[model samples]
Target chain A: DNCRCAQCVNQDTLQRNFDTFAIPKDLSPQEISPKNDGVDVLWSDSHKSHYPWSWLSLTLRDISHKKLANQEKLWGATIASAPPEVRFDDVMSSTSPKGLADLTSKIRQYGLCFVTDSPKTPEATEKLLETIGPIRNTHYGGFYDFIPDLALADTAYTNLALPAHTDTTYFTEPAGLQAFHLLSHTPPANKPADEVLGGQSLLVDGFHAAETLRKESPGDFEILRKVKLPWHASGNQGVAIAPDMAYPVIETNGGNLHRIRWNNDDRGVVPTDIDVDAWYQAARKWDEILKSKESEFWFQLEPGRVLIFDNWRVLHGRSAFEGLRRICGAYISRDDFISRWKMTNFPREDVIASNMQLR
Target chain B: DNCRCAQCVNQDTLQRNFDTFAIPKDLSPQEISPKNDGVDVLWSDSHKSHYPWSWLSLTLRDISHKKLANQEKLWGATIASAPPEVRFDDVMSSTSPKGLADLTSKIRQYGLCFVTDSPKTPEATEKLLETIGPIRNTHYGGFYDFIPDLALADTAYTNLALPAHTDTTYFTEPAGLQAFHLLSHTPPANKPADEVLGGQSLLVDGFHAAETLRKESPGDFEILRKVKLPWHASGNQGVAIAPDMAYPVIETNGGNLHRIRWNNDDRGVVPTDIDVDAWYQAARKWDEILKSKESEFWFQLEPGRVLIFDNWRVLHGRSAFEGLRRICGAYISRDDFISRWKMTNFPREDVIASNMQLR
Candidate 1:
């Protein structure tokens, strides 16, 4: 037989099983008072039931309380700063749980980070990535090495002056964490003097730029947030995987900035129904904000250094280079990075309960 | 100077360029008649603009006609049958575009398909996949080989009965196409004389089951469609990649079935606020429909054959087996498969315009 405690028995089932007064027509307690770690319930049936506070607390917490709220700290161009850095070896070799927790926390706060003195090998970069989460294998193989190849299918494989953009914008779900390691950089054999000075890596805090735009020009920001622009990448010659996707330039979920997708080069035909002139004006303003020095972090990646950042929040680019550069990198899915963060910090029960309520 | 055609010119700018009557205050046609492959537009300004029918057709098609509509064929247990199949060699070696078009069309029409006579090699399977699209690399790699290893981290690598479910449901965007190629199978070393069976692949048309439930039990179907359930997979023991995601069991976009996520094994803790008994009853009913013979297709996958199916519509599983089985497989992103389908059939302009209007 099931336990007869008031908390364990279903009131409706009990009403059917017994006479009205035997189980109490109204199971609502006639008198209730807190005891030592329990509640004493005096029923109309002249029967009493004792309920432990632990069970009551667990069962009533969701209905009795609001979800825990954490406001995301939004930054602007003037407020932008360099991402916090950690030694590559410290992240790879640290056995202390606090070290990993600190790294993941920094990633969540700053959307970008740098690790120096990493071993100049793809395997080393991959091993370091594992400390955070699994490598997200994409069309580009996991832990892929990049070198200038004339036969490259993507623009990233060339030595051109790239503009600020997010990688794989054409992908419905773009890679989350992009990790780049500069394995080697040798001056080009027949390099032009002017070209030798270029090829520096560029980083832009898209979130900061977006937040600034939202405050400065709400109309432009709203257009970018609502208008869906088409993005496309041609399948490699002789290959049959030409992907095309359309999404708002700025995306939000529950009033929180979710993602930013911008790639002028990969952009496809604009829809004819939208006001082309208005769209252009809004897009230009956004581009100006994205490229402004206040929103940019420029640095030349040296050998044995790796850069990892949130692909959704940060836009990456590189100036033209005339050099023999060898780089290795990998992509991590967003869910994996978030999972690692939750496991390192939040309690599993709390995370699940909060997400359930939000949904 | 801008084109003066009503369709091409910007109305706001045009008003400023010319006097009201000079350019025609209202370009509404006085007499619109079709000539030889052209339309004669007699404007109120006494200006006649001869517009080619093709241009007029493309521009006026929206107002003049309804879009092409194709109803998706949904099948249930009795109506369900084995998916239409093609030979692997025909897909790989055929020079005709029709071959690939037929395959992709079949996939779109029926959520699953099998290619017979595939060479018993991982490379062959990959080559055939490349014929349709690039391989979608995942945590498992570009192409992964599976063999029974006692130390395997995932349950899929072991010889256990798998419940009908979609793969990678815990990922924010689950893989689109799952391709499986059975490489080899050997009887277990300790097999009993009477136990000479098992290890057949199982598939269920999740969309069919959902639609059936929608008709038979609207309340249960509604709950499944509206309730967001948390899904989680513990990082493989010793591995660092664990993913957690929440999505409704049944999802739709613009009244079209978009995705189905169900995995009892990967389901996380249910929320406390929901009626536990009611949810359990609804879930049990769904499971019953999913497992019913009417919705299931059972078959033994032999070596030298590959099965490819949509992860969004078809749920895959396997019966417990006592034998040595080796399999190789890879996941293709949904965007890629859709891209291939569109390229092989639908015109890009038509698709974009339709999507824009829908939004």
Candidate 2:
């Protein structure tokens, strides 16, 4: 006998004022009155509840076939020819939020986007991010603007090539979104502009690679999905960070592949208790797919341009470089940006109804 | 083929310099040499690698039986008599860290602890939390200290009693640890000390309740664990927080129950495709067990008594009251505090071995 009448719930706070648990176990509907759009039910306990037709028809209705799995636009090297992009100035405009909305939608569909003509300073980049959500703070601090100073123990701080992997695999909930603004990448003074080499950024559609593996070898995909692997970052002083719960390399939600965590460097030693050989074999197939020519998109970052990508769905890497290169970026928590996106794309009424449909 | 020799890995960065993917697929061990503590192998590629004995023994070794599940000490109403506690000064002390160590251990095993003789001020409370880890910032901001001013739209801003439930169900990764410091609980100006009732706090061991349900009804437990439910917090202005992936009320890691996310008020409308009747039945049983006398530990908060609990494992609630009460507290991220806990409990060498064994 759960009631949702105004008397039972406070409109201001949206919290229940009536005791739901106190309702008798035998409580049943005393009367049901049909309405144009819904029905009103009077319970034996004298409480009332209103259920719309939409909610009433949902009982035993299978929504799995309507999942948003295929809604995403998976891509690979082909995406390099036509990258999704938006002007930085338009996104920061206060009068029209269409630019920000477009950027968010592009990231949602393609897992990555570029903001061209952005300011080449760290402060401006941080302000641009704040327009969407708060900058997530970590042991490394909130806004990162640095060169290869070797200040932190991560390989990202060194001028070395990095394999395609997601950052912060050690975090229990790895960062949801990551951004990189290449302020400047000065070539060696002795070398000509044409001779300058290395430092090309790599982006891989993890979802696309994952789907390939699923179609090519379902058994290998199953092994990767079932095994929970540990990761860590202990090189920094007094920071032996490790998640309490290890996660599989692949994670699914509502029967759809959602996240991929692949970092050979941060991956901890395999526990002797698991099927080590099988795990390795499956991981090998995954690696092969990630490194395939058709799976990789390589491009050189330019000044005054910012790149944002979904860390949960995309893998990134960098070739070794020599020069005074500076990059600025920050991590944004998933909940924050998702809130902004929904508010921008969906109407307020629709949002509330969807949120309270089953409640 | 995955060689981790000194030349292949940098000692300072702990990052592999060699390309593990470059090793030929047909490469195999040419010779195997046994050492006292480990073994050495020479590969067909003329590469040498070492494997310690401890690392070698983990393969196919069933560590599930050796799980630390039993290492935790679950409790019920009896905990009210002798709750795990520590002096505030002891935890904040730097000379001898035994006090902080004890507090961490108690929280790790029992999921809750009380810090007695704490300063009755918001600043002091925030400082106390920083001794353990950085305060987690959220939409509500960090270190909450306020009265029922309706400044924000949340049920917590009222004096009404709340059911035993976890907080922040809408978050993708809920807060790991939460602390509450009751600065003052002044009864109605006309009420006397003995008449000052109905402000006691409630605590329920979620793990204990889940275990009870598992034993009492396996079918219901399975439904609760497997069915991913939606949750949302759309009351606040400009904030419609909802996770991208829905999670079950009960979550397990490595075949053991690890987290409980139960907030009936925050739970969103259930999707129509699932077995709605079965879910309701299982949830009803859960509510019964949580509200049972054996599962609840009630206590009145004193000005100087600070209560800290693992939000992932414990459910908290409060009783309705007519009074002016002020509470100050903050959320601590999982990675921050877990890092501190592991560092305090395990030796540094063992920690390194555990982190590096699989890599």
List candidate 2 segments past 4 Å from native.
A1-4, A13-16, A53-70, A186-198, A271-275, A355-359, B1-4, B57-70, B186-198, B270-275, B355-359
- Model 1 TM-score (B-chain only): 0.78
lDDT of 2 by residue, A39-145 (tens): 89988878778876654453335332232113689998999999999899988998988888888878888989999999888988998887678778777877789
Best by TM-score: 2
> Model 2: how far is B184 from its true place, Å?
3.2
DockQ of each: 0.14, 0.42
Where does model 1 exceed 4 Å of error?
A1-82, A94-100, A184-196, A238-245, A269-282, A344-359, B1-72, B78-82, B94-99, B134-142, B147-158, B189-196, B217-220, B238-245, B270-285, B344-359
lDDT agreement of model 2 with the native: 0.80
Residue B95 Cα positional deviation in candidate 1, in Å, after optimal superposition? 4.3
TM-score attained by chain A of model 1: 0.78
Best by lDDT: 2
lDDT per residue as tens, model 1, A91-185: 76657665566566667777777887788788888888877766765555566887887454676887877777898777778778898888877
